[model samples]
Target: MTDPARSALMSKVKGKNTRPELIVRQELHALGGRFRLHRKDLPGRPDIVMPSRKLAVFVHGCFWHRHQNCRMASTPKTRQGFWNEKFDANIARDQRNAFDLQQLGWRVEVIWECQTRKREQLSASLKKLLVPPENHR
Candidate 1:
């Protein structure tokens, strides 16, 4: 695709309410997890926040967040330099946000887009996330 075509395609991509995000949101609701969406006051405006639990969840796209060993996280065939820099910045920002959230006493969990593909596995993981540790119980 030409540069203009690529730009237009990328422009259509949304910042929120993406397919993976919707899947996660639906599952969370099914699992009885109540969360606030994208609280601007929080660092990185986490996708889901449970204030009572002091937990923040981020539903990250594999390509944008550079998920390790994920097929969906392939680098673009064109613009290697630009993509690398963009991916690097995104990773850095994610790290910074996670660190900030932790410092503020919030436990953070990141759910990759690929993980949501398998409903059973995702449900198990979500159960673990929503459940307090045995010691806490």
Candidate 2:
């Protein structure tokens, strides 16, 4: 596609409140996970923040975040150099953000877009993550 078309398409990509994010939010809420959205004070402005649990969740897009071994993380045949640099930067920033959050005593979880597609699995995995250690059997 032309540059203008590609730019327009990319512009339409929502940074927050995306479909996958909304799905994760719903699942978390169903599990009685009370949370805040995008806390600016935190590194990476996590998608979901549970202050009581000191947990920060990032809902990452497979393609944008370069989810390893994920089909969604395909590379563009054209603009190879540009895409590589962009993906590398995204990965680096994610690592830095997670490290910073960890240093601040916050537990971080990353929910991939592909993972969100299966609601049952996502809910189960979230339950495990959100459940308190004392409650786990």
Candidate 3:
């Protein structure tokens, strides 16, 4: 593809309220998880912030965030150098943001895009994260 076409496509890719993010939001609502969106005060402006639980959730795109062991996180065939640098920067920024949030006493959770593709698994994971673990005695 030409540079113009690629640029146009990239421009169409949104930063917030993406389809994957929306899915997570809906699931969280269904599970009765009350949260705030993109708190500017927080590092990296987490997608979902539950102040009551002191937890911040980041909905990450597999390809963009370079989810480990995820097939969807593969590098693009074109612009190898550019993509590598972008992925590396994204990973670094994510690590820095998570660290900052943790330092400020906020628990951080990252839900990858590919994970959200499976409704059942995603629901289970969300429950696990949002719900307190039961004592097995």
Best by lDDT: 2
- lDDT (CA) per prediction: 0.93, 0.96, 0.91
Greater lDDT among 2 and 3 belongs to 2
**Model 3 poorest 10 in a row by lDDT:** 128-137
Give per-residue CA lDDT, model 1, range 1-137, as digits (tens). Answer: 99899889999998888898899999989999998999999999999999988989999999999999999999988889999999999999999999999999899999999999999999998988888754444
Return the TM-score for each candidate structure.
Answer: 0.95, 0.96, 0.93
| TM-score for predicted model 2 compared with the true structure | 0.96
User: Which stretches in model 2 have alpha-carbon errors above 4 Å?
Assistant: 133-137
**Per-residue lDDT tens digits of candidate 2, residues 24-94?**
99999998999999999999999999999888999999999999999999999999999999999999999
Clashing pairs in 3: none
Identify the leading candidate in terms of TM-score.
Answer: 2
Please give the lDDT score for candidate 3. Answer: 0.91
Name the candidate, 1 or 2, with the larger lDDT value: 2
